[model samples]
Target: MTNTALTGVIPPVCTPLTPSYEVDTGSLTRLVDHLVAGGVDALFLLGSTSEVAFLPDRHRKVVLDTVVGHVAGQVPVLAGVIDMTTPRVLDHVDTAVAAGVDAIVATAPFYARTHPAEIRAHFRAIAARAGRPLYAYDLPVSVHTKLGTDLVLDLAAEGVLAGVKDSSGDDGGLRAVILGRRERADIADFSVLTGSELTVDSALWMGASGVVPGLGNVDPHGYVRLVRAARAGDWAAARAEQERLFHLFELVTVGGTRMGGSSSALGAFKAALHLRGVIDHPTTAPPQIPLDEDETARVGKYLAAGGLI
Candidate 1:
């Protein structure tokens, strides 16, 4: 079990894939090295940015093994066990533990309508079975169920959750969790991390323990500087850094006219990585369109504007 709270910039890393959609172990290792060298606090694999829902079982395992082996315990590796049900998620948890992950992140059951009680039960079941720490992933956009503040607090109070990753973009709800933990003496060390890359500075100002910015995969150094500034109470510096990142985030909308948010954002990240020579290819998983030449050029422009190119 992890004794330390997960605090600081932990990017939901994008999985590098070959032309045949195989996990490119060499490129993935280089990506990990880039983030570690950028001074990120941890690495989150197989999360939304990783195309977890689209990756096959074999591909997921390969990614886990490759990243775990490459990282070599230099920083905490949090793996996402994303599945539609408990048994399936447990299977992933088993595989991730076997691959030497420090913790597991799971979302509310998707593709099936589930009640709040069921959501609570789902987390409890995982916590009871998982050998490592489990963090609740509140991604209503994908799971179709928002993890309520009360439910999260209840789980924390009962020791069923080690932390929460709030991607709901609900600052009110995020603040509730942060204040809830602070007011409760029963819940000790419950980490509250935000996945809103655009509002990282505000989230940190609201007392979030950390952030899981997908944009960090493209510019890890910027996020690191933002986190350091926030922690040191340099709000002006943090705001400046975050504003720069927000401008860089415009790359996600470069191809929005022809693709969904995931495709555009993930594609932009991979493209930026490829342009930087951190990865071999900018290919994303299937069913998601890759950025065209014009779109990729837009990404390059944004990188140059951010001084990342």
Candidate 2:
């Protein structure tokens, strides 16, 4: 990894929107302030948690510029240049680089069924011109393609990738990437961050560089504390905190049969933020059902138990 490699609790920030579906600049700024005050090491914008797939290009630009300018070098900002293919992703890459982000994150090609070599070519094309550190976002659930460890290691060895955020839900795969990075002295600084919030204690114990939990948007301080405890080798404390967060994560299921998993999870997050006074409203982008009063109350129950209230 380069000197600019991001580490620690870098939360994938939620995009707070107005009821009319425009970017709520004030609420968005307040959300940035909330994360910074929560002791987050950095911020990740336009990721899955930010409703990146649902947002229009203009809205995406607004979010990238707003958060980056508001942060003003307080913490390293990572922009997710996610799209269907390399060309579209490069467009976002150009925009993000112009906006002055610290890093760029992209995933393997999707929607058109790309081969492994094509995925390699996709990342190589981005790295060659990104003008910033590049991290692979291994999220098989959304993109339908899993970036193999060999592919990642090959790219890292060639300096095309600085780090990887392992959200593949494959613990063995995550370990292999971390171990692969450690095995090579030349790439010893390569970072291996995990997006699995519920198993962060174990991921940290296995030597993950940091975490990028979506739940961090709701309770960033708790994740910071968990990381500190793990760093101090307080495994017991880390486990306790992880379990507490696991309980809080239950709020994601509050939407029940009424909505999809994305709606449930994102809705609960925004709802908790709203109940905590971080944003003006719990509104998601669109089509993702917004949680009603009863569902939001269920989210509050988890927040209260997690002591985030």
Candidate 3:
């Protein structure tokens, strides 16, 4: 892969599942078409929004092959090599690469406590083996270790990383990475993408290259509009659209009281997709509770208000 940094709206594509909790390839194709039609620049598969951790290895492979074949180079596809440690993640990297992904996003080693040095080594090892451009996924919420700005910038300087996805929810920390990248001339192409969906305008203002919004699955055009408005320097329009999406994002909380955060958010996203006729059903992975009728109806209202349904 070229050192060119990935930019623009790259949505974390959702996986469409059948009632039996299997990959609904037909619905998955429709969902991909929905996103491409809405003007996304790239597609991120097997990320958190895709319920990657819950999926079996074969299912993950199915998703990669399906999307890569369906896309046919229309947009670059980025796959997540998310796992507990370097070795396991390398297996995923090999799979993603063989399946023809353009880039691979990985999180720091998790499930066991690791020092900063160990984390750095983990990434260095992956970069040495991945054979594709590697982007660090800084999701402290799951990884349990905040990837500090210095660590990220240092790795970028060493060419061990191509970019970073700042989903840590610390805008202050994220701003530091953006500013740090700007200060360095050698790694100028180091892409600083924000996973903080609601604050994309602010992230862009801080010099972020793009976004990896999960909400982009439900409303890809809205995020594309947000990015366009920001690029055009229409801050007011960007702010207005962001606020509207913020309201639409309320759908994620409908089932919050009954299930975990991940379950609720993923369910709401799938429910909205099903209501919009993009997917076949709203069945989340096993152990993750599915939304009942009332909860799904709340998702419908949000989509309707957002003019999606």
- Candidate 3 CA-lDDT value: 0.92
TM-score of every candidate: 0.98, 0.98, 0.98
Off by over 4 Å in 3: 1-5
What shift in Å separates residue 187 of candidate 1 from its native position after superposition? 0.8
Which candidate has the top score in lDDT? 1
Residues 60-167, candidate 1: write the lDDT tens digits: 999999999988889999999999999999899899989999998999998989998999999998888777788999999998999999999999899899999999
Segments in model 2 whose C-alpha atoms lie over 4 Å from true places: 1-5
Task: Predict model 2's lDDT versus the native.
Answer: 0.92
Tell me how far the alpha carbon of residue 178 in candidate 2 is from the true structure, in angstroms, after superposition.
1.1
lDDT for 230 in candidate 2 is 97
Q: Which lDDT value does model 2 have at 44?
A: 92
Clashing pairs in 1: none
Report the backbone clash tally of model 1: 0
The regions of model 1 sitting more than 4 angstroms off are 1-3
lDDT (Cα, tens digit) per residue for candidate 2, span 101-163: 989999998999889999999999998878778999999999999999999999988889989
Deviation of model 2 at 34, angstroms: 0.6
